[model samples]
Target: MTVCEMCGKETEVFSAIIEGSELTVCAACGRFGKMLRKPVMRVVKKQAVEKAPGPVETVVTGFASLIRSAREKAGLTQKDFAMSLNEKESIVQKLENGAFVPPISLAKKLEKLLKIKLVEFEQEDEVSNEKRGSGPLTIGDILNVKK
Candidate 1:
């Protein structure tokens, strides 16, 4: 016997998803959500060695405009594009309107379907525009010394 989540009565509890929330409730309260089956637990062994993380990749800006243009160029409507990508039309609308950025998997699908570059790699050794236009560099500027 355990505590009832909603009524606070001491009794057995079952897992249920009520109003988009998962809770442990009694049979009476379980009516609020669909009854969920008990989850199974399994144990596994881990490797002795751990690998280091890899470099981060980033999505390019102006993706919304690019997507819209590509879709238009392909002579496909939003509904047609969604059907081609196997995604919802609303998702296509949101992606085209810049309301959201698709996950990596979805981005890959877009790249394949539209033939446009959406993701770019970040280079740590790259020099930025700010460094290039820092008002005519001198030896001291290169060596980081006080003028």
Candidate 2:
């Protein structure tokens, strides 16, 4: 029997995309990701196979350092930056501390305000990431999954 990828609970597993990876997980843990509809596969010739892998996207590393440097360079306190982004100071503090991944929306806001690219597309280089450290959960994190 399969188990939940997020919580290690044994139950019916559904294929879902959590963060960027696909996983088979229990219904409750699947609530942490987007439930995907099955994609129809068509058999194609060998030539098409070589072009299948698309561009790889990489998030800029040292995000916390980047945020802290930019904020300090702009002479904005964490509270001030948070207010500008409509986020809480504690969130900014956490982000600058590398406590979690910033949401795409927040990352975009930071890109604009901080004048830095937080994401980049690589045409050739490929990188694979496994699951990260288990961290505390929040309601919003759970609700983000398509149930």
Poorly placed runs, candidate 1 (over 4 Å): 1-53, 123-147
TM-score of each: 0.50, 0.46
For model 1 the local lDDT of residue 107 reads 86
Judge candidate 1 against the unseen true structure and give its global Cα lDDT, from 0 to 1.
0.82
Candidate 1 per-residue C-alpha lDDT over 59-144 given as tens digits, one digit per residue, 9 for 90 to 100: 78899999999999999999999999999999999999999998878988899999999987765332334555657755543453
Angstrom error of the Cα, residue 81, model 1: value is: 0.2
Candidate that scores best on TM-score = 1
Question: Candidate 2, which segments miss by more than 4 Å at Cα?
Answer: 1-52, 123-147
Question: Which pairs, if any, clash in model 2?
Answer: none
| Each candidate's clash count | 0, 0
Candidate 2 structure quality by residue, lDDT tens digits, 40-143: 33578776444445676566778899999999999999988999999999999999999977977788889999998887776753222223235554454434
The TM-score between candidate 1 and the true structure equals 0.50
Clashing pairs in 1: none
